[model samples]
Target: MKMPFFTSFILLVLITQIAIRRTSYKIESKEADFWEKERKANFTRKKPLDNLNYIKIPLDSLPFGKLDDDESRYCEKVIRSLADQKVVNLTGFTNTDLKLEYGAPNITELTKYDQNYTTLVTNLQKWGKLLYDAELYNEATTVLEFATDTGTDVTATYKLLTDLYQNKLTLSDSEKKEKISALLPVAEELRSLSKDQIKRLLTESL
Candidate 1:
């Protein structure tokens, strides 16, 4: 004898329910596996500080390196005299792309009035890197802003600063507002300069 219509209907409904449950379980398992892999990958990535290998060099290399023996001796004396001056430690900045300017020595005497813009830009960049390495991202951004204000073409620097700011979960609302306020003038200065003038400034400084 044929099965009753209601019995056939019940069997069909139970089969559909079982199939739907299996599909849901499979999707859940796949999602769980994806999250686990992402977590492990993030944990294994290298720390930023460990990757930086900063090397300190004289602010003006050619001027110092080309000195005659006697002049070199005099320069050395000057350097020794100013040795106690404090300079920001840039030990966390990578040396790659820093071919021209690296960190400055702790010697204030070497800096003079009417300093070149490169010197100014280099110092600002170093300070920024030092601050970033120390986890003072807001301060780092401020210093890099100074570099941008001086027409240093700090697009890459700004991008990096933006990344740091976005990831800075520890900062309070007031602190972030203060940083933005400080950056406004620098942004205005950058906007005021013509592209040619910025290039000229860089050329003269270099």
Candidate 2:
């Protein structure tokens, strides 16, 4: 038997309410769990961070002056400011993880380390793009390679490298494929939201 139109509408509304309630419950559950973990995190003691792998910026090796535009010069200045800075690629780790790893007291210093890493990676991407835009293919690759080696999770960095290997750089067919193939593990290990996109791009390119 066919249900009346009003009866069908009411049934649909009821189903929707049930789904909304379930979703709200899940959200509340997760929030409660996170808070409980955070409370534990506060009690964590300081851990040694002396063994961190710090990234060093190769300022002299990178192509820094092909373009004299305002943006290019600004990026160079920013990069130079980081010459003496400490950079560590802790991209996949979260705040809670940091607190747990190095204790709450050391979070401040750890945060700075990560901030420098982020700053360097971001500027590297911009600098590389600027170089690529100005037809500085080899120079762009140098910048991009440094970012890649430092474990940047930025998808654009991977994309730029892929483009250069395939079309821009003067590499043999096997060499091009080989270089791109090496990026798979790096992309696969990414915890960034863009991980899937980077993986997909690399997979298809290979």
Across 22-126, the per-residue lDDT of candidate 1 in tens digits comes to: 999999999998667545544442332333322233444212223235534454444333333322233222232121132222112112211233344555555
Report the Cα lDDT for residue 20, model 1. Answer: 100
Local lDDT at 45 for model 1: 29
lDDT tens readout by residue for model 2, 1-206: 45698899999999999999999999999999998888777889988888888887887898878899998888888888888987788887888888877798888888999999899889989999999998999999999999888889998999999999999989999999899999998888787898999999998998
Best by TM-score: 2
Q: Candidate 1 — worst ten consecutive residues by lDDT sum?
A: 105-114
lDDT of 1: 0.46
| CA RMSD of all predictions | 19.4, 2.5
Q: Which sections of candidate 2 miss by over 4 Å?
A: 1-24
What's each prediction's TM-score?
0.29, 0.86
Give the poorly placed runs of model 1, Cα more than 4 Å off. Answer: 1-115, 130-153, 191-206
